[model samples]
Target: MSPVPDHGEESYIGSDRLKGRKALITGGDSGIGRAAAIAYAREGADVVISYLPEEQSDADQVLEYIKKSGVKGLEFGRPP
Candidate 1:
């Protein structure tokens, strides 16, 4: 994969539309969920992501990006 499936790591432009909000996202370890989590954080919201234990690595990446967005991020993992 070319990583062309944008998780908005760079190309997203946030305008604080979600400022002072909180979002809970499932499947946030990858795909659209991951993108949403990143976008939510960039838009100035605290984010919580849910995923399976096996997806922890991917979730961790999302968390990093979320933090870089200057928003708080939380994660929960369940056994698959």
Candidate 2:
């Protein structure tokens, strides 16, 4: 099993550089994709993440962090 890694869970800080922006990221349930999702959310962009259905657990975590940024967070997953 791949360990669920921390994607800047406590290290990233934002300054609204990307306020009012929107971003769509594929494979965003983990790894670099998860990191990017967190970064975009912190920067003030509403984020949408797409991932395989089996990755829902990881995706949920990302969504939690994204929403904490006070921006909208959306997720799309494929049917297994």
In order of appearance, the predictions have TM-scores of 0.91, 0.89
Q: Backbone clashes per model, in order?
A: 0, 0
Of candidate 2, the 10-residue stretch with the lowest lDDT total is 1-10
lDDT of 2 by residue, 1-80 (tens): 46856688789998999999999999889889999999999999999999999898989989999999999999989564
Per-residue alpha-carbon lDDT of candidate 1 for residues 1-80, written as tens digits (9 for 90 to 100): 78568889998978899999999999998999999999999999999999999888899999999999999999989563
Backbone clashes in model 2, listed as residue pairs: none
Model 1 spans > 4 angstroms off: 78-80
lDDT of prediction 2: 0.92
